[model samples]
Target: MTFHKEDQVLYLMAEHDLATLDTVGLKKDFRTGYDSGVYRITHKQWGEPPHYAQAYFDENKHLLLFSAMTDRGFEQLVEAFNAFGHDFPAEPYLRVNLTMVTTANEILKKKVVLNEYHDLFQEDPDPESEKVLKEINAFIALVLPDINAGRTPGIEAAIRKSGIDPENARNVMESVMGSLEGLPGPKGKSPRKSPGKSPVSGKQKKLTKQLPAQSGEGVRLLSGDDELLFDLHLYGMAGDIRREAPWEYLFEDEVFGVQVPGKDLVYFVSVMGFEGEHQALSFYKGYEGLAGFLEFRAEVGRLSLLGLPDDGMLQASTMTGGLMTIPHLMLSFTDRDDLEKEDLAAIKKSGARFRGKGQWPRIEEIVPGHVPVYPSKDSLTELFLVVQQVLVVLEKDRYDDQYLMREEDPDHTILVRVPTGKGPRFRWRDHYLVVDPKWGETSYAVRISPASSVALARLPEASQELQLDLFMLPATVREKGSRAYFPFVLMMVEKLNGLVVSMSVLSPQPDLESLYESVPQRVLEELIKSGHRPSRIEIRSDLLFDLLEEILEKAGCRVMWVDHMLQMDEAIMSMISHLS
Candidate 1:
C-alpha cells in the first residue's frame, strides 16, 4: 500500500503462484514493491523494511503478498493474472490467487484463503490488527524513509523536534540498524521458479497458436499485461510489428470493437481453454444494446457482479426481476483482415468445426477493406485506448424529479424492443411470473422506486388519502390465455410527510376481469386503512368507470369517468411516469 503523508486506509494484496509456492519470497516481494515506489532503498542490507512486508500464503495455494496505493492499482494486481499470467512459463492461470487485505498488517495477522473452487477469498479484516497498524502508521513517517535515505542528521533533527536528547540520536540509529539485521531472511534475491521447467512451455512449443484465438479477451485488474495491454504471442502467430506505427495519431471512432473475455454467465464453464471460453462467448448476452453496457463495464469482476445469476439474461430488471449479464464485442468493427485464399480456407475449416456450422457470424465473414486487421502489435495497443473511449457515455440523464428516472436507472429500465420469440417474464409485485407476449412494448411501462417509497406506501397511516383509477390500454398478448387489452391502474398514495410514494406497476394480465376486482380491492383496503376514502373515484375511461362501479360498490366508493381534469391529471402523471 502506498502510504501518503496522510492516509487512513491501506490495502495489502497477495498474488500467489500455485506453480512455485513461496511463503518467504512473498515477504521479499512486498518489501521490494514498497521500496521501489516509495522509499529510496539504495541497499537492502542496511535498510529494514516495515514488518508489513511479512506475508503468509495459503498452505494449499502458491501465493505472493504485497500492497498497493490505489484502488486501480489493487485492481490491476488482479488483472495481472488475466494478462501476462498466460505466458507459457507462468501456467496455472486458474490457480493463481490474488487476495486483498484492508490493512497492510493483516497479511501477517489474518488468514486469506480461497474457497474450495478458488474463485473468491474467504477472509476479511481483523479489527485489532487495524488498530495496531494505524498506530504504526502514525509514527512511520518519523523513521523509515530517513533511514533508507541515509540521512542520520535528518533523523536526529526529527527526533529533536519531538524534544528527544540530541546525543541519544546515535543510539536510536544503532537500534534501527540492529532491527534491520535481526529480520528473519537474508537480504538477497531468492529464485522462486526453476528456469525452463514450466509444463506449459513444453506444450506451447508443439502447437502453432492462432492470434485472436478462440479465447475470450479480458482485462484482469493489474498484472503487467493490464499495465501494457500488449500480449500478442499467440499459438502459431508469426508476425511482429516491423516498425511501431503512429497508433497514437488515430481517432478512437475509427475502430469497430475490442476483444473481451467471456463475461458473467450462468452456464457452467468447466475448462479455461479457448474452446470453452468461445462457447461461453456464444452464450454471451448484452442488455438494451449499449446503455446497460456502460454501467456494467465499471462493475466488471466486482463482488456486485457476482450477485443475481442472470440465466435468461435481463431485458429489463423489471422484465426479469433480477440483475442480468450481457456482453459487447471487446473486438471492434475493424478487427477483421483480408485473408489469402488458402489461409482463409484453413481458418474457415477450423471455425466451422468449432462452431458446428458451415458459415460464420456476419461480423466474422472474410472481407477485404471492410475486415479488421489486428495482427500487428500497434493495433493491439491501440485497442485499449479505442475501447476506453468507445465504451463510455459522457452524458448524464437529465431529470426534473427525485424518482429514479427510467432514462437514468441502467439497472432497471430496458428499452422494450419487441422480442421475436420468448421474451422475459414480467414480475408483477413478486407473485405471478406472467410470460404474456401481449406484455410487449405498447402498454407496458417500467421504472425504479426507492425501497423507502415502497415501504411508505404500505404503512399504517389511516389519515392519508389515495384513489385507484384504471385506463384501458392494449397489451400485445402472446400467451395461450392473454387478452388484447388490459386495465392499467394508478394509485396515488403519499409517502412519509416529505418522502414521495412509489408508483405501483400493475401488470397487464391475460385475464383483465380477474384483476378488475383485485385492483379496486387493493385500493379500497388502502383507503380504509388510511381513513381517507374519497367521495367519488374520478377515472378517465368510461368502460372502466362502469365496470369499476360494480367492483368498488362494496367498498362504498363512488366511481365516474371524466373527460379531462387538471387536478386528476397530476395524479395520473405519476402513473404515466413509469413509461419514461
Candidate 2:
C-alpha cells in the first residue's frame, strides 16, 4: 500500500511538471493568473544563485521547495500566506505550495512552506476533520466567485478528465457565489415609497390617526344665569357669591360634534387671593374645604369618583342625575340654593334617581341650604414649588373676588405646553417654560421681552416673574388602546404681550420604542383606571414601517432598497415617499 501511494504521488508530480526553465518576456493565459516564463529573484542573499528557484506544484497537491533565498524573503512569503489565508480555499488554487530552503548555514529560515494534502484530507481519520472541511467549504463560497467564473472551463475539464462529477464542482462554485451575494449592509434597507400613493399622504394619515380627534368631546360647568356665569356670592347665602367668595363657570363648546356635560365630572374648587403683592393660595385652598370635607389628599393621580360611568352614561351627568348627585350625597345641601337648583329640582320632581346612593339617606334630610365653602390649608405647596422649578409662568390672574369673569379668565390665564419626552430645553421670549419631567430639573426660567409683544396690546410693566406649578403628567395613546406614560412637565406661563405662549423641554420617559413594546399591558391598565375609556383605534402594520423609515431619515442615514422593504411591510408601503 505504501509503495502504491508513493507511485501515485510520483505520477501526480510528473503530470504537473514542466522541467525546462523557459526564460523569456512576459506571457499571459486566461485560465491561470500570470505566467511569466522567466524566474528571477530581484532581492535575495548575496551568494551563488540556485540552479532552479521557482514555485513548483504537482497534480497530487504536494508542494516542493528549492532556492537560494534570504531571511527577509522567507518572512515575506509567510506574511503573504497569512494575509491570503483570511478567505483562502482549502483546495489550493494552483494545487501546490512552494518553499525555498537554504543549506548554506544549515538554516531552514530562507522560506518555509508545508504543502497541505487536500486529497489526503478527504480520507482523514479525525472526526474534527469534517468540521474543518465544512468551514473551508464555507470560506471557498465566500472568496472564490470571480476566480471560479474565470476558471470554469479548466476546472470542469479537470473534474471530467479525473472521472469526478463535473456537475458537483459547478454546484460548489455557484453555492459560493450565492453565499457571497447575501452579506448584510450597514443600513439594512432604504426608505420605500408607497405603491399607489405617495408616502407623505400615508404619513399624514398615520399621524392623524395616531392623534386623538381634532375635535374633543368634554363637558363644561357653566352657570344657568343669563350671562351663563358661575357666582360664589350668588350661590352663597351671605351675598352675591361671584363678588363675595369665589366661583368658576365652565363651558363646553361641543367641539368635534360631542357634548360634554359639566355635572358628570367632579371639580375640586379653590380660591386664590392676594396676601400683599405676592399671589398666595394653597393647593388645598384650590380644593376649597372639600379636601377635609371629602377626605381628599395631596396625591394627584386619578381620583376614583364614586359615581363615574363605565359606559357612555356621562351624557346623563350633565342632565343632572349622574355624578352630580355626588355633591348632594356628600354635603346634604338643598338644591334650592344651587345655581341649577330650580332646573335640577324640576328634574328630580319629574321622578328620576340614577341608582340612588344605596347606603345614604335623602340629601334634603341629611342637611339643608347651600353647601358652605370653607378654606383648606394648602398641603401641596412643596409639590407646587417643585413644579415651579422647571417651568415659567407668564400671566397669573390675581382676582380678589371669589368668582372672576370666565371671559376674563382666558385673557389673563397662563398657558403652558409641557414637553412629552427626554428632549432639550429651549426658550421663547415672553413664553412660559414647560419642563419635561425627564429633564430632572425643577424649573426653567424664560425672559419675555416687550419687543416681542408688540403684536399684543403692549408689554406689561417690563417683565414679570411668573411662578409655575406643574400638575399634568405626560401620557400617550398609540391608537386608542395603547396608552403610555411619557415623562412630562406642567407649568403655567404668564401672557406678556398678546400671545399665549409656553415652552416645554423635551424629556421622554418610557420612550416611544418601549411604549410600542408594552402597548397591550398599558392599555389594559388605563382602561381599568379610566372606566370611561375612549374607543380603540387600529393601525396597519405598514404604518409602523413607514414611521421607522421617517425616524431613520430624521436620524441621518442613507436608505436603500426601500421599495423592497415596502413590499414586505405593505401597510406602510404607501408612505415610502414621505420625507418626514
Best-performing candidate as measured by lDDT: 1
Estimate, for each residue in 1-580, the C-alpha lDDT of model 1 and write its tens digit.
2222343223333445444533233333333222211221111221122212222334344444433333334444334323433332222222211112111123124343322222232235445444444433333346657665765546644654444333333334443453333222333221122223322222211111111222224323222212211221110011111011112222211111222222221110011112222211111122222323333333333323545334212212211111122222222111124334533453343222112231122112111111222233332333333222221111010111211113233233221111111111111110111122222112212122334234334444344322334442222224454323333444443322312232344554533334443454455444544444455555544334544565454445555654333333344443335643
Task: Give the alpha-carbon lDDT of every model.
Answer: 0.30, 0.23
- Residue-level lDDT tens digits of model 2 in 1-580: 0011122100011112333322222122101121222232222222122111123333233332222123333333333323432222222112111100111001212222222322322323333323333433443434355453554435544444444334434444443333223222234221222344321222211111111212213421221110111111112211111122221222111001110121111122222232222111122111122322222221111122433233322222211112211221111222233424443443343222222221111112101111212211111112222122111211112221111112223222222222222111212111121212232111212223333223122212223322121111213223343323223221223223212123232222233233233322222232233222122111212222333333323222222221111111221112222511
Model 2: lowest-lDDT 10 consecutive positions: 96-105
- Model 2 RMSD vs true structure: 37.2
Residue 299 of model 2: what lDDT?
14
Best by TM-score: 1
Q: How close is candidate 2 to the true structure, as a TM-score?
A: 0.15
Q: Residue 256 CA error for candidate 1 (Å)?
A: 10
Runs in model 1 deviating more than 4 A are 1-260, 265-386, 389-490, 493-524, 530-568, 571-580
